[model samples]
Target chain A: MSQELIDAITDMREEDAVAITKKLLDGGASPVAVLDACREAMGIIGMRFETGESFMPELILAGEILAQISAVVKPRMQQGGEDKKLGKIVLGTVQGDIHDIAKDIVGFMLDINGFEVTDLGVDVAPEKFVETVKSTGAKIVGLSGFLTLAFDPMKHTVEALKAAGLTDVKVMIGGGQIDENIRQYTGADAYGKDAMAAVAIAKSWA
Target chain B: MFIRPDNWNQMSPLERRQARLDSWQNAPTPPFVSPEAEKNYRERISRVRKIYDMAPHDRPVADLFMGANEYIVRRKGFVGKDVIYNHAALREPTLEFHREFQPDVSVGAMPYPGKPWDMLDFKTYIWGGQKLPDNLAIQAVEGEYMLASEYKEFAADPTAFWMKKYLPRAYGALGPMAMLPDFPRISESVDTIDLLVPFGLPPFQEMLKKMMEAGNELMRILGEVGQTGAMVVSEGFPGMGFNIVKTPFDYLGDTLRGTKGILMDMYRHPKDLLAATEAYVPVLVNSIVGASDRTNAPCAMYVLHKGADGFMSQAQFEKFYWPTWKQVMLALYEEGITCYLFIEGSYNTRLEYLAEMPEKSLVCHFDKSDMKRVKELLSDKFIIAGNVAASLMSTGTTDQVRAACAELVELFDGKSYIMTHGCYFENTTDDKIRAFIDSVRK
Candidate 1:
C-alpha cells in the first residue's frame, strides 16, 4: 500500500493519490506512514528533476498532490503523530525581487525533506529576515532573488543576520542569475542552482 | 500598398525579402547634426547590414542594451518613478549615454507611459512609479488571466477571447468589455445595431471615456519620446530594435496563463494548449510584420521567456514551445524581417534546436548560456551576440569586466559575432559599461 501511494503521487495521478490517501487512513494506516510515502514520492520526483527525466510540471503536480494528501492526513495526525523535523530554516525572495515560484519550490522541497521552513514570501527586506530568524530561531536561511538588484539586498541580509549576532546561521542563495561569484559577493555560505541543491545544502547544515 | 512593391505577390519569398532589405538599406536618412555625423551613420549602417548578411565587415559591432532609468538614477539621482511619470525626463539621460558611450547602436529607451497605465488601472504589470517608487524596472504580476477551462474558447477565436474575456481580466477599467457581443456573429444590419446598444449604457460609456483619455495621454507621451528618438538618431546612433515580438508559447505563458498555470496545463490540457499556441502564430507574425513595415526597420526583437532549459524538459520544449515559435520566425523571415532573440536564460541544452533556424534570419543574443558551447554549436549557422554576465558587470571590478570582454572578443576572433552584455545594464555602473565598449571597440 505504501508503494502504491508513492507510485500514484510520483506518476501525477492527482485524484488517485488523494483517493489512496483516504483509503489508507480509513484502512488503519498511520498518518506518519502516509506522510512518509509522500516524502518518498517527492524524493523520486526531485531525483527525476535533477536527472532531467522530469521537469517543472512534474514537480509542480507532485507538490499539488502532496498538498492534497497532507490536507487529508493532517486531521488524523493531530491526535498523536508528532514527527520530528530535521531542522528549522527561514526562506524568502530578497528585496526588490517579487518572484516567488522558485522560492516556493525550495520551500516545498525543504518541507518534504524534513525541515521546518518559515517562508517569509517575496520582496523580503533584510530587517525582516533578522526579525524572522530572531522570532523563529531558525539556523538556516535561504535568500532567493531573480534579478541583479537583489544582490545588494542579499549582501545586506547576510550582514543583518550577522549584525543581529546570528553569526552561526547558514545562508544559502539561489535564483535565476545567482552563481558562485554572486555567492561570494553576497557573503552567503553557499549557492544552490536549484531546489534539490537547496535540500542537499540544508541537509548538510542539519 | 505603400511599402510593398507592385510585383510583391509575383515575387518569390527570397526576392520579396531582398526587396524589403533594399528598402531598409535605402531608407531616407534622418537629419544629421553635421557631415561627420552623417558619415558615421552611413558607416555604422553598412557595418550592421554586412553583419546581418554574414559578410566581412570593417570591424566587429558593439551594442548596449540599457534603459534611461540607469542613467537617471546614477547621474541625476532620480528614482524610476521620476522618469516613468515624466516622459521628457528621459531625454537628457538618453542622449548623454549615447553621446558618452558611442555604442554601435542607440540605447533602447522605450517609454513606459505611466499616466495611461494609471488611468486604465492596469492589472497585468506593476510599473516602476505605481507601486515601488524605487523599483528599477517594471515588474509583471503573473496570474491566470485565462483559466484552464478557457483554452478551447481561446483557441476557437483569440480575438473574441481577447475582447470578451482577456481584456476584462487584464485591465480594471475594461471590465465592461466582457459585455461585448461576439463580433463574428454580428454580420447583418440588425445585429450591428444590437452591438451599438451596449455602447449606450453608462458603464460602457464610462469605459470608452477612460480609453479615450488613456489614448490621449499615450499620444502625448509618444510625442515626447519621438523627439528624443529623433535627437538620438540626429547624433548618428542608428536604432536596431524598432519593434518587438513574443514567442507564441511565451505569449500564452506570460499574458494569458501565468507560468505556473501554463506549466500545469502541459499535463492537464496539452492538446488545448498546443492548439492555442498554434492559433497565436499567425497573429504574432501579422503583428510583427505590420510593425516592421510601419517602423521601416527590418529587425524585430524577441525577449524569449519560459522556453529556457530549466523551464521544461527538451521533449516538452520540442513539443510545445519550439514548433509554434519557429513557425512565427519562419513567417517573419518570409516577410524579410530579422528576429533578434534574447535567449534570457541558459539554453545550453537547446542549442541544437536553435541551430536549425534559417541562416541569416536570427541574431541569438544569449544571457547565461555557455558561450564556448554556443560558439561550437551555433557560430556557423547564425549571427550570435552577447553574454557578458550582468552580475560581473554590476559587481565585478572594471578590470574583471575588461577581462570578460577580451575573452569573448578573442573567442569569436571578431567574426560573425556582436559584442554585448548578456542582458540590459540596469544595475551596471558607468565605468564598467565604458570599459566593456572600450575593450571591444579597441
Candidate 2:
C-alpha cells in the first residue's frame, strides 16, 4: 500500500495520489508511512527537475500534491506522537530586492521537509531578519537576491544578524547567477544553487 | 518566410554566417518611396554615412549611446515628483540639460499620449504597493500574466484571447474587460464606435480620459521641443534611430507567460510554443518592415530580456529561443537593416548562437557577460558595445571609473566598440559619470 501511494505521487497522478492518501488515512494506515511516501516522491520530483526532465510547473504541481497529502497526514502524525519537527528556518529576500519566487520556493521545500519556515517576504530589511531570528530562535536563515545590487543588503542582513548576538545562526544566500564568490562577498555561511540545496543546508544546520 | 536547415546545429558557425550573407545578397531591394520622402531618406542616410566615415578614433563618445532614464531623471531634478504625467514639462529642462551635456545623440522621449499600458494607473495596477510606480527600465518585474495551461488558447487566437482572457487577469483596471461578451460577428454596416460605447462604462471613461490627457501633454511637449532639431543637428548631435521588433519567444515569456511559465513550457509544450512562435513570424515581419520604411533608419534595436544564462539550459535555448530570433534577425537583415541587440543579462554561453549572424550585421550590446571572453568570440564578427560596470560609476572613485573605461577603450582598439554601462546605472553622482564619459572621449 505504501509503495502504491509512493508510485502514484512519483508518476504525478494527482487524483490517484489524493485518493490513495485519503484511503490510507481513513483505513487507519500509519500517517508516518504516508508522509515517508510523499517525501520519497518529492525527492524524485526534485531530482527530475534538477536533471531537466521536469521543469517549474511539474515542481509546483508536485508541491501542491504534497501540500494536500501533508494536510491529511500531519494531523494524524501529531495524534500518533510522530511529529518530530525537523527544525525552524527563517527565509527572506534581502532589502533592496523585491524578487520573492526563489525565497518562496525555498520556504515551501523546507516546510514540506519537516522544517518550520517563517517566510519574511521580499525587500525585508536587516532589522527584520534579526527580529525574526530573535523571536523564532531559528538556527537557519536564507537570504535571497536576484539582482547583483542586492549583494550589499544581503551582506548587511548577515552582519546585522551576527551583531544582534545571533552568531550561531547559519546564513545561506541563493538566487540568479550566484556562485561561491557571491557567497563569500555576502559573508554568508553557505550558498545553494537551488531550493533542494537550500533544504540540505538548513537540515544540516538545524 | 524563414526555412531552417535540417541540421541547423550541425552546421558550422561559419557556414551559418555564409548562408545568411548569401540570402541577404540575393534578397529583393526595397520599393521606392515618395520623391519628398526619398529626399529626406537620402539626407538622413547622408548624416549616418558621415558619422560612419569618420575615423573610429575621432567619433565622439556621446554619439555612441544615450544616457539611461534614471540618470536623466535624477540629474534633471525631477527625481521625486510625478515625472511620468508631467513629461511635457520636461521639454525646457531637457533642452537645457542637453545643452550642458551636449550629448551626440538625443535620448528620444517615450511616445507621447502613449498607449493604455503606459498610463501610471495601469502601471500601478500591474505592480502594486508603490509609493510611486517603479522604474521598470531598471528593475525587472517577473509577471506570470499568462499561465502554462492557457497555451492552447494563446496559440489558437492570441489577439482574442489576450483581449478577453489574459488582460483581465493581468491587470486590475482591465477587470471589466472580462465582462465583454464574445462577438459572434455581425454586419459591419453598424457604427463600431457606438458598439464600443457600452464597453466604455464607469472606470473605462476615466481611463480613456487619462489616455487622452496623456496624449495631449505629449503633443505639447513635442511642440515645445520641435524647434530643437536644427540646434541638435548643428551642434553635431545626430538623432538616435531605433526601431523595436520584439522576438516572439520574449513576447510570450516576458509579457505573457512569465519566466517560470515559459521555461516550463519548453519541457511541457515545446510543440505548441513552436507553433505559436511560427504564427508570430509574419506578424513581426510586417510590423517591423513597415516601421523600417517609416523610420527609414538602417538600424533596429532589440532588447533580449530572456535567453540569458540560468534562464534556460543551452539545449532549451537552441530548441525554443534561437530559431525564431534568428529568423527575425535574418528577415530584418534581408531588408537592409542592422540589428542592435541589447543583451540584458549574462549571455556568455549564448554568444556562439549569436555569432551565426553575418559579420558587421549585429551590434551586440552586452550587460553582464565577461568582457574579455565576449571580445575574443565576437570582435571579429560583430560590433562589440558595452559594458562599463555601473558600480564604478555609482559608487567607485573617479580613478576607478577612469581605469575601467580606459581599459575597455584600449581593449577594443578604439574601433567598433561603444563605451557604455553594462545596464542602466541605479544612481550615480555627476562627477563620477563625467569622469567615465571623459575617459571614453579619447
Candidate 3:
C-alpha cells in the first residue's frame, strides 16, 4: 500500500480525472485503502513542512501528487457511503485575483484531514460564494485571495451570507499576501494564516 | 480626497504634541546587525554604502531604527533614561526553546515603532519584485523592483487622480493606518505563518532556523566593519538588507501568464493603477516605514546572481525588464521612501531612473555601475556604497584584494562610501575577508 502511494507521489504526470481513476484501478486500491495511504503520506509531507524540511514549492508538489492519486480512487470511495461525513466546507479564492497557491493548499489540507471540502477555485466573485453556500448549505466558507482589493469582496461575501440568512456558517480566509489588520477589518470569523492553519481552523470551526 | 482637517491652527498644544508623538511613534525600523561586530559582518554582506551620516545629530541612528526593541529596553529603563546605548541594534533575545541569544547587528531606518516588523517585511516580499502572474496594478511593467514611494505623496492628488489614476488604488486606502478592514495586514504576516506552519506544512523550518542563525553571523561581521559613508536611515541596524529584492514582474515574465495578467491590465488601465498607487502610497509608506524604525528600506533583489551587474545581457533585461521597475519606483517616490532605495543589480539599464530617483536616494552597491558617473550624478546628494565584487575575496590574492580596495577607493575619488563586496560572502577564507577590510580602512 505504501509503495503504491509512493509511486503515485513520484509519478505526478496523471492529473485530471482519467489518470486518477486509471492509477487507482491499476494499483487495486479501494477507496478506503486509498484514503489511508494518501493520509499517511501527506502526514509525512506535513511533518517535513513543520520541521522546516520543506518549502512552499515542495509542499505544493506533494499536494498536487496526492490530488492526482485521489482522482484515481474517488469511485471506489463512493461504494462505501458509510464513511463519516466529517461536515462540509466550501472554499474559493476571492474575486479579481486568480492566484491559487494558497487556495490549492487549503483545499488539499481540508481533503487530507478528512473534511468534505468543496473547492470552487480562484477568482471566484462574491456572488458565486453566496450561491455555493446557499446551494450546498455549507457551514464553513473558506475564502482566499492574493490582492488587498479582495478585502471588499470578502466583506461583501460575508455580508451577503448574512443577508442570505446563512449567518451561522463560519467564514475563514488565508493567503500569502494577507495581513492581520485585514482579518479585523473584514470581520471574518477567523483568519487561517497558512494552509495547515486553515485546515486546523476549519476543522475546529466545523 | 482626505483633505486636511478644517480645524487646523485651532488645535490645542497637547493635541498637536500628541499628533507628533503618534507620527513619531509609528515610524518603521530596518534590520539589525551588531555594530560591535560590524567589521566581521561587513565581509559577509556584499557592499556598504555610506551616503549620509544616519546619525544626523549626536544621536545613535541604529538605536532609533530598531525602535520596538529599544522601546522595550527603554520603557523598562533597564540602563537609565539618560544612558543612551551606543549602537544597541543587537539586543539579547530569548527564543521559544529556553535559549538566550544576542543576534548579530542589523541596519534599519526606523528607530522606535510600536509593533513587530512583519507587516513591512512580508508586504515587500509580496509586492517588491516583478514576478506576480499579473501586475495587479495599472502601473506595473514587465520587470524591475516595486518601491512604492509615490504612495507617500497622495495627499496632494485629486479624487479622480486617486480612484481612476492608480493601480490597485484600493490598497492605498488600506494599511497600518488605514480605516479599512483588518483582513489585509493581519492576514498576511503571522496569520499566514500560523496557517502555513500547521496547515500548509512548509518544509523549511529547520533550514529557515539555520538560515536565521547564519543570517545573524552575517550581521555580526558587518557590525564593526569600519564604515566610511554617512549612515542614512540605517541608524545602527544593517538588516534593511542593502535594499534589493527580485522583481516579481520577472516572475510573471518567465511564467505562463507572462505579461498577460497585470501587465496588460496596466497599459489597458494605466490611469487606475496610478490613482490607486497614489492613494495607497501614504498608508503603505507609513506601514512600510513605520513597520520598523530602520535607517533604510529592507530589500535585496540581485540574490539570484548575488548582485549581478554584468551577468545578465542588457537586451534580455531590457525586453523582459525595465518598465516594471520604472512604475514601481515611480509609485515608491509618490511615497517619501524613494530616498532610501539602494540598487543591487545592474544599474546600466536604468541609470537615468536611478539618477532621477529622489534626491539623496541612490545607494549604488554591489554592481559594475560606472564608478565615476555614479559619483558625478549622485555622491553629493546620494549615498554611494561599494563596488568591491565578492570575486575579489576568493579569486584574488591578498595583494589583489588590497589592489581592489585601492581601486574602489580611488574610483570614488574620496567621496563618502562604504568599502565591501559586490555579492554575499560564502566559504570565504577569513584571511581574505581580513585583507579586504585591512586594505580598505587604510
Best by lDDT: 1
After superposing all C-alphas onto the true structure, candidate 1 shows an RMSD in angstroms of: 1.9
lDDT of 2 by residue, B1-442 (tens): 2233577567654444344333432333233334543343344334334333222445424332433544655566654232334455555565564556655455434433322345423431222123323432324467777777777777777776777777666654566665554455534767565557546687666645665775676676566445444433433344545577578899888788776667666655778888888766777777776775565545578878667765666776788888988888887766556777888767887888888887766877877688888888888777777776554555566787778778887887745666676655445676766676576564
lDDT of 3 by residue, B309-375 (tens): 3222344344334444444544443333333333444455455546655554334554445677777
Candidate number achieving the greatest DockQ relative to the actual structure: 1
| Number of the top TM-score candidate | 1
DockQ versus reference, model 2? 0.17
Which residue pairs clash within candidate 1? none
Give me the runs in candidate 3 sitting further than 4 Å from their true place.
A3-31, A71-82, B1-136, B139-442
Question: What would the per-residue lDDT of candidate 1 be over residues B1-442, giving only the tens digit for each residue?
Answer: 1199888878876576667666776677669998888888878877877777778876668777532235433465655676577678778877877777787877745488889989998898776767764546567898999989999999988888988999988999999998887767888878977778889999999999999999999999999988888887888877664477789899899999999999988988999999999998878888888888887777788989899988898889999999999999888888877888888878988999988887777888898889999888888877888888887876788999889889988988756888877765456677877887787675
Q: Per-residue lDDT tens digits of candidate 3, residues A1-53? A: 55555445533332432355466667675667666666676776665555545
For residue A163, model 1's alpha carbon misses the true position, in angstroms, by: 1.5
Q: Which ten residues in a row have the lowest lDDT in candidate 3 chain B?
A: B93-102
Tens-digit lDDT track for model 1 on A182-204? 88898999999999899999999
**Clashing pairs counted in every model:** 0, 1, 154
